[model samples]
Target: MSSPLPLVFDAPKRGLPPRHLADLTLAERTEAVAALGEKPFRAKQLSRHYFARLNVDPAQMTDIPAAARERLATELMPQLLTEVRSVECDDGATRKTLWRAHDGTLLESVLMRYPDRATLCISSQAGCGMACPFCATGQGGLQRNLSTAEIVDQVRSAAAVMRDGVLPGPDGKPAPGRLSNVVFMGMGEPLANYKRVVAAVRRITDPTPSGLGISQRSVTVSTVGLAPAIRKLADEGLQVRLAVSLHTPDDELRDTLVPVNNRWSIDEVLQAAKYYIDRTSRRVSIEYALIRDVNDQPWRADLLAKRLREHLGYLVHVNVIPLNPTPGSKWDASPKDVEREFVRRVNEGGVTCTVRDTRGQEIAAACGQLAAEN
Candidate 1:
């Protein structure tokens, strides 16, 4: 049978902005600045203001000559995202922002603050082309891949919000904290936009004056079992966590749920994941969304555990996500009892499993829900 999945990476580029500082390396930035008739050191100043201090306003960059600030900002710091609206929930600990790109494309990024760490879930593309029937984003199909700067800007914006005490804490007070974690679980299959996503990761984990300086361990890049891409990422020599959205263990069920499974079988994906673990020495995360009466059968869970144990052997953890049913969709989350049993069976087979904490349901925080509604 012909594959149902849409090839997303080659999608047409529309409204992608001109080159910005975030898209360039330090040397490249220096060259870009000099092209504007400024000294090489000006690039470092701009990087400090944007990446290190999270400030982008040209008016506040007093260190640079006033005449050059506007020119540099206009060229290097072009505004990429404009907030359309922001909604908060979970006692003000979770905030989701709807951003309008230059081309009027709508994308979303969620900032969720927990007791121990704050995590930002950012989108890698405007819409997804994986065609996973259950996913709101996937259902809409791919719009275009986000540029490297656009991806990095989301993290920088969230980190600024955390540092500036913009979002309220669980105690209902403006509690400033660090943005410690980032997950590429928002809209597109991250690995589909492989080059930009990899560039974004480097811009996120590199230390001050170069990038965001967040530890690689704190960043998680999720994919829907793109086996070759998984192996390619393993060789990047970074410690960032890898999450596979393997909703089912059996090729039969997975082929229907995750359309990409038709191309890369479950065993092939798992073997690639094993290669990742062997190379990175970091535990892989298996994300399984439990749909009612679908892939949530206890026996499937047992098979999931068995397959994982045979391949990963304690080097993996299963994050069982209760289905966030789309509006008017037939799919529904598995019952609590069924969910519990699924977890139980996975553990019984010698693999760790837990139900993930579902957040921002009220604000359409699950993937492309907000953009779809808008």
Candidate 2:
């Protein structure tokens, strides 16, 4: 067991984002519309345009009267994210967007187009508070927690781009498709921005006209061993998969690699993961970044497998990611032979494991590469 979490996790909130339609629930939208001297039905009309139709510009909302469009849209749908620039790789199959918020905060999101489905990796915070030395975002330190609207707007923008064929499909040509997966694996330790992240998840998984209508099962939330937050998320009746970024199995190295481990031991983290499985009945994912000899040792592989089996049994899957080196970082990915042996030892020890298919390294869109730099 580990000691209680320290109270110094959250960074100071610099500025609160302006209110937007994505921030409010269905009932709140109606109340706001009535308060603005508009008919209650206007709320549903505005929501359907923004959520279902992916239209945020008031000019395109022809359903509403010309006289009322500006007021209703301006008050409810203020633009939250403005595209700074986008870089693409993999024959246009992967696109990373740099966005500037209203307060000039920079954050990044990546959209990858696969043969069958598209997945968007969205950031839950402007930068990270976790202070993991190997990660680019963590090295920059946390800017602030994003508002619920800022988080959800990233998903909304990705869905719109996918629908509009902005990113090329498998054949190197533009083809419209639907976004099927969302991952909270960019820019931040999601659990540190707990409330807004949970609200954004609800808005993403809720029904059409109220949300983007994505399945809860298709979404994933990743953290670096925030044990109490893990338990809090499990009780929320959500089906989203929990991904723990446990780069190492032992506390000695993990305390330096993942700074949060100093607060919560590996045992406490896995125990919290076990509680999550008990509540959601979902297999938790263990994310291990294999960085050369630092954490790719054969003995650590066995220890990882043993620890997972003792706590989670079959309710766990391990995803070993080859470390994506950031600029000027000493960390390098483990050699292919070493990575293979590590996978072999883990599976031999009874826990199934696979290497992640890395993408967008050329444009710095790969795992742990997002710094949201200008």
Among these predicted structures, which one has the highest lDDT?
Answer: 1
Q: What ranges in model 2 sit over 4 Å off? A: 1-8, 367-372
TM-score, cand. 2 vs. native: 0.97
Candidate 2 lDDT tens digits, 113-220: 999899999998887778888888888878888999999999999999999998888777898999999999998888988999999999999998888899999999
Report the lDDT tens digits of candidate 1 across residue range 293-372. Answer: 99999889999999999998898999999889899889999999999999999989999999999998888888999999
Predicted structure 2: lDDT? 0.90
How much does each candidate deviate from the true structure in C-alpha RMSD? 1.2, 1.7
Worst 10 residues of 2 by lDDT: 1-10
My TM-score estimates for the predictions, one after another, are 0.98, 0.97
lDDT of 1 at 88: 93
- Per-residue lDDT, model 2, residue 108, is 92
Query: Which residue pairs in candidate 1 have backbone atoms (N, alpha carbon, C) closer than 3 angstroms, thus clashing?
Result: none
How big is the positional error of residue 341 in model 2, measured in Å on the Cα after superposition? Answer: 0.7
